[model samples]
Structures are given as C-alpha cells and as structure tokens.
Target: MIHKILNNKCPHCDKGHIYREKNIYFNFRKPKMNKSCSHCGYAFEKEPGFFFGAMYVSYALGIAEAVAVFIIGTFFFENTFDLRILPWIAITILLLSSFNMRMARIIWIYLLKGV
Candidate 1:
C-alpha cells in the first residue's frame, strides 16, 4: 500500500506503469497516462467522474503534509506562533502540488479499481 501510494503504481501489481511518462516531475505539463496497465492491463480510468475522488485524496494529502510541517517546525524551531511558518507551508504546498495531484489520482484509482 505504501509503495503504491508513494510510487504511484498499480496497487495489485507494482510492475505496471500508472503513467506513461518517465517521471512525474517533468511530466506535469503533460501527464501521459496509459489507458491500461502495462503489466496487468488494468484500466486506469474506468469512467467519467472516476477521478473526482482524487480531490478528497489530494485534500487529505495536503492536510497531512501541512500538519507534518507544522509539527516538525514547532519541534525544531521552538517557535510557538511564527507567521513565517505560514509562508513556508504555502511555498511547500505550491512546490509539491503537482506531485500531490498525481498521487491523489493514483491512490483513488487504486482504491476503486475493482469497483
């Protein structure tokens, strides 16, 4: 599960490529997703609105990331209430938004693949 979520591969089989591009970083402008899995041939997108669930996944990931940053910053910086933390979090989210979007969709596909 962790591997599937983090690497964005088919949950049942890791050999398949969830996406067609070499990597997600440079492929943001054009996400070339395979219509079906290369290994298992599992359909990546079943129907319209299938990926809507990815929104929830994205929100969950964003919240988790924000909370993690808040906790780590509070622990190491020892700053109870620092306004800079807000900017830092915002920047982090902005930079990671692409990856978050892809991961969210991948997770959603994995969860609802059988359905």
Candidate 2:
C-alpha cells in the first residue's frame, strides 16, 4: 500500500496509475488524477465530496513538514527560537504543496479502503 501510494498506483489494483503524471514535482501545474482505475475500474472518489477529507490529511502533512523543517533549521543554526527559519519553513511548504496534495489523496484512499 505504501508502495502504491508513493507510485500513485491505484490501491485496488496496483497495476493502474491513480495520477496522470508519474512525477508531479516542479511541474508548476495541478496534478491530474484518474477518475477510476484503468485496470480494476475502481473509483478514486467514492462519492461527492469524498476528497474533502483529504484536505485534513494535507493540512496535517503540511504541519508535520513545517515542524520538521523548523527542527532541522534550529539544529543547523544552533538556535531554538530564531525567527530566521520561518521563511525557510514557508518555502519548504510551498514547494511541497503539490506533493502533499497528491500524497494526502493517496493516503486518504488507502486509509478508508478497510472501512
């Protein structure tokens, strides 16, 4: 499942891709997702607004990434409370926004697969 998520493969039938592009980073364009699995015909969005939950996941991922950046920056600079890392954190988040969105959606899909 983790492999599938990372590769953007359909959870239902790992053969089919969930996203149109194999790599989404540095493209400066929104990632395009397939409506259903090409191999298994499984729907990506189970219902209307199903992906809304992915927003929460994305937010959590952003927070985690930001915290990690802050911790790493502090350790590198030997300053625990320096505000200089704020811009770096923001930049990291901005750069990873697209990745977080795709990851969040993939994670959300696998998370609810059991239910």
State the lDDT of candidate 2 residue by residue for 60-105, as single tens digits: 9999999999888977786688989999999999999988998999
Per-residue CA lDDT of model 1 for 1-115, tens digit only, reads 8766667677658888787766774344756778888898888888878888899998998998888888777866756877768877887788778888888888888778678
- Per-model TM values vs. the true structure: 0.86, 0.93
Clash pairs for candidate 1: none
Best by TM-score: 2
Q: Please give the lDDT score at residue 82 for candidate 2.
A: 90
Strongest candidate by lDDT: 2
- Residue 43 lDDT (model 1): 84
Which stretches in model 2 have alpha-carbon errors above 4 Å?
none
Estimate every model's Cα lDDT from 0 to 1: 0.79, 0.87
